[model samples]
Target: MRTLKAGALYFVLVFGAGFVLGSIRVPFLVPRLGARFAELLEMPVMLAVVFMAARYVIRRYALADRRTRLLMGTIALVLLASAELLLAFLMTGASPSAYVASRDPVSGSAFLAMLVLFAVLPALLPSGAVSDNPFKPKSVGGSDSFKR
Candidate 1:
């Protein structure tokens, strides 16, 4: 239902960003820096995308319940993994096991960690902090009371 929709949107946002970043990283960064360093460089950007996308999906869908958020994250992870494997199969004729085995060990481990973070982030994020401004001070009195 709502969780499904939220999950799909989250997957689209993060996956789309990754696809674009991969496009750049493969042809440009990989040759210059090597796979491990290129992938390591890309990790921080992907992490930011994951965090922002998770926050956006949770807030937009009103996914306040912990179970609901977890379900959404899981759904998104499944979709993302499936899409990646399918693309790898089509592009390189690599089986899933072969595809995984081919990854640079250091970069691959980081990628695995990112995947775990992606799966759990929605559930872990606080639901109450809906304010757009991160630095806005909490209000103490009537006139300055923070407004949603």
Candidate 2:
């Protein structure tokens, strides 16, 4: 249940960002730079969103175990892909096969790689240090190791 909630939230966050970015990219960037360049330019921003969204979901949901994180990521990936295909069909009247075939090859390949990254990122990110002050370094051996 927790994993499901986390995964759904993750999907919403990343997909929402993509929707907004795509709105901008399609109208503004595509005309100016062309499809492939516009999509390439958008990739870094989407990557940042994916990283932050994955980290936030994992932490918010207390997804500590590797298996749980992996499951959550998998769920989000499936949802994201479905949503993309549905959106393409609705907006362009393209069948799933047509949509896939119409994608710019270079940008489409990059998008596929991003999808893989999005799926694995939750499990890949570190959970962070167990400290209130995350910047404070831990002593090597003993609590007094830093003292005079």
Candidate 3:
């Protein structure tokens, strides 16, 4: 339930943030940076929101399960990248030369570095951090507790 709420919050934040940024930049940044930059910025924000959620999940439950967290993060990054690629096709009909060129060309390390940053930030919450879980487990009729 916390994850769902966090995801919903993430979606809303990213959606509204996109609109707000778009509206402000429609006449300026959008033209200078092109639709691609605006889009690239938006997707990262959404992914960050998701990462925030995942971080919360990790800290709140003390899951401490790196595999699950890493998988969740990798999935988010791939989805974001796919969305960016698809949006590139839709907006410009071709990928910008600058898009790939702007990064460090040393074995594609910079591009992969950004990917890693997004993939890992969510799991960097301070040790022993905790989140308030409103929908946490509750005791049933017997002594067993049901996980929400």
* Alpha-carbon deviation at 120 in model 1, angstroms: 0.2
lDDT per model vs. reference: 0.92, 0.90, 0.53
Per-candidate alpha-carbon RMSD to the true structure: 3.6, 3.2, 8.9
Q: Which ten residues in a row have the lowest lDDT in candidate 1?
A: 129-138
Give the candidate number with the greatest TM-score.
1
Model 1 stretches astray by more than 4 angstroms: 130-148
lDDT of 2 by residue, 1-73 (tens): 9999999999999999999999999999999999999999999999999988987787677777877888999
Tens-place lDDT digits, model 3, residues 38-120? 54555555456545565655555454445544554555556556655665568666664545555335424534665666666
Cα shift from native, residue 51, model 1 (Å): 0.5
**All candidates: TM-score:** 0.89, 0.87, 0.48
Error of 2 at 75 (Å): 0.4
- Full-model lDDT, candidate 2: 0.90
**Model 1 per-residue lDDT tens digits across residues 1-148:** 9999999999999999999999999999999999999999999999999999998888777777988999999999999999999999999999999999999999999999999999999999986744455446546576656666
TM-score of 1: 0.89
lDDT of 2 at 142: 85
Off by over 4 Å in 3: 1-26, 30-63, 95-113, 126-148
Query: Candidate 3: global Cα-lDDT?
Result: 0.53
